[model samples]
Target: MPLGPPVPERAQRLLAQLERYGSREHGQLAVGRRLLAEHPDLPLDGFMISSSMCPEPGRPLHSLILRVGEHDTDGITAWARALATEPIIDGARHQLDTILDDIGIWASATISEADYDMDQAVFIPSGDDVSFTHRGLLVTEFGEDGDLLFSGHPPAREVLAATSAYYRDTCGQRLRAFDGRDLADSITRGWCRFVAYPTRTDWRIRSASQDTPGALPVTWMYAQEGDTQDLGDPVHCPACGRSSRGLDYDHVTGQRVHLCPSPVCRHQWPVDDAPDLEATEHRQDQRAALAAH
Candidate 1:
């Protein structure tokens, strides 16, 4: 018996294909990838979402996996924070404070198709992972294999309330408890995280904190990566990973901020640059300019 809301037409077709997997769970892997590809919509334009799904019909469990991008987190937090101060928000004020506590790992909000504006102020992430500990509650969560984790019950608002305090106090640290258990223990413990949604096979999770430790406060650190000087062309847009004459050159930095030619992308290059590259250029430019002098 497939559970949760009516499976989307696309999903139903995909599931049919996997029905024969040992004749029970056929399209589990494809479903997992689709989960990442088909994410729910957020309120704003600058948000992105990805997810993975695992099905264990034998155990009667279906888990939907989601990974929030950094920008979406920031947008949600900012919206939540603005809503906090308004009257009659009923704990919205508190929710904003909690979101601010660990803005990176615990900043999030969900609106039920209402035009209500928020007095709370949450600063959403632009270049990081999902903010808020559980900003991830599903409006309707379901596994491709036909399992339901949460939806329309206890309402997303209530779950936020239950987790608000714990996340609010953590301060840039993430508190992951699955199926009502601590995250670390879930990873190390017996089948707990797996049970959070009623699951059975191939469930794994990794935290952003693990990758970058020793962070400061109010959100430890932004992700940093080394650049390849072989960026090909410095004048091309660093954003779409494309290079074209259509770029915005920073007068101050003399660096290119490429704009995507595609109307859909409309993305601008990131302001950050390689400190190493800058230094190298500065030295080389000095020698050339000195020779000219």
Candidate 2:
């Protein structure tokens, strides 16, 4: 195979920069620092840089894999276009346009419940043993025979919105969508439980069995906001005697309930029965005031 055309002076500078600071651990941060100094007005959340081994073996390819956040996509697209005009190899020039196309797709792409056929679609959540390579939620779907149907790490915002819509419309209940980072934390904390629910279910949550190949975590089951439920005082689990700090859906009763976080207990009770932490604090303050008098 041909070694390709000579690299342009501009490409040489970029290649030198990549050599100096393009490692996975520090690449984005280094580029971000440069951008901040040079193009302070440009909006950027994060970016990635990767290069392939050339056909010659042991040599870096002329083309680079560059991906930027949506906020900086337009600016990066323009920059890539300008860079493409340099006297670089054909493959490098082609890669510039490919990068732009990828950015466009990422900007418009979304994972919606409507994208899948409800009759055959099932949502699979990340398991406790599963590790994440990125910050976003990884959505995976599998067929009945344990065949991979679809998988994508869609934007966390899109994933949350799609999940909320799916449960609200299909399950006949609106579930509070927790942040992807928080959900990941819940998994690490061992607060998540997986349950397989058929896309056509009538509000019945079923445990995953041999027949059910797909399963998704109930976000409400692991994390809860204080305002979402009214707990009159800090309620303790009857079984574990630990303060209830999360809400879980009781599939048997079809009601939201306060959940005990104890790994051994895993007990749940009615949400209405949960005591308000703020009220408990207020009452304690009153008792302390009387004692002071």
Candidate 3:
């Protein structure tokens, strides 16, 4: 068989590491550090060894076996050099775009609820729009008129547009019209508050809170700001009128309900039932301000 392109320097180093450490066992972090130090230009993130995984774990270099199309270590090493030298950032971006593309294709073709549920396999009606929670990463929304509101995050807006354009320009499929700022205020604010990033394993963007490393806070923060602001505040329970800090926000549904800090009261009601005076007053002030303007 004819020889292929020379193994890339980065892959060559990984091959060397695999030889020294063996492919089955975890290599020293120092090995990865040395590899990284050697190639300062390579992106610190997004390098890939295959479609579903990357070379970031123990014996990550051996992961090249997925790409090299061979089981033998020698063959894998020989082929790793020929792997594309594209920056891992590009790979990450490409994967993101691909996810957006999948979402766009599904949303564009989906006319009825059945159609939407067919491919995405997940849909939930939230407020005025319907959220297509496909794979729980790319949540595409549609308006009442069945228009594509938005998909993915702000950072990937361009990629989303390009995918929509591709459907329009190439496939002649007129994707539902989308607005640049169609994301719900809650989603927008939550996205702004949290950070999301993709991994080589998949295009899922892991979300972490702005203040700490965790999921985004419940949507109640966007529901009626003032009340949710003091997540921990003593308040009179609507059911028992007892003052307690038992109010807790459900992370999944984003609903705030009093847990009744006072064991005697044991009152539980949605935040709607026990509107905070401060929030009500704030809303009144806002209304007055708008009226004045």
User: Candidate 2 on 122-141: residue-level lDDT in tens?
Assistant: 43444332222123444222
Task: Supply the TM-score for candidate 1.
Answer: 0.16
Q: Candidate 2 or 3, higher lDDT?
A: 2
Candidate 3, 1-293: lDDT as tens digits: 11134555665555555445432243332333343455444332212222223433432222221222212223322222323222123211221111111111000010232222222322222332323332333333222322332333444444345434534444454332111123233233332121111212222222345564333332211111112123234567777776754445433344456566676777666767554555456556656798999
TM-score for each predicted model, relative to the true structure: 0.16, 0.20, 0.20
Backbone collisions counted per model: 30, 7, 2
Error of 2 at 250 (Å): 35
CA lDDT scores, all candidates in order = 0.32, 0.39, 0.34
Considering only N, C-alpha and C atoms within 3 Å, which residue pairs clash in candidate 3?
A: 7-81, 8-81
Model 2 residue runs over 4 Å out of place are 1-40, 55-67, 71-73, 82-145, 148-293
Worst 10 residues of 1 by lDDT: 189-198
Poorest 10 consecutive residues of model 2 by lDDT?
101-110
**On residues 1-293, what C-alpha lDDT tens digit does candidate 1 reach at each position?**
45246655554544444343322333334443333234323233222212126523332233222223322434445444443532112222112222112111123333321222221221222212222334443321223321123221344344434233333343232223321223222111111111110111212121223223321112111111111122233455455655543334343354544446567675666445643356447656766898999
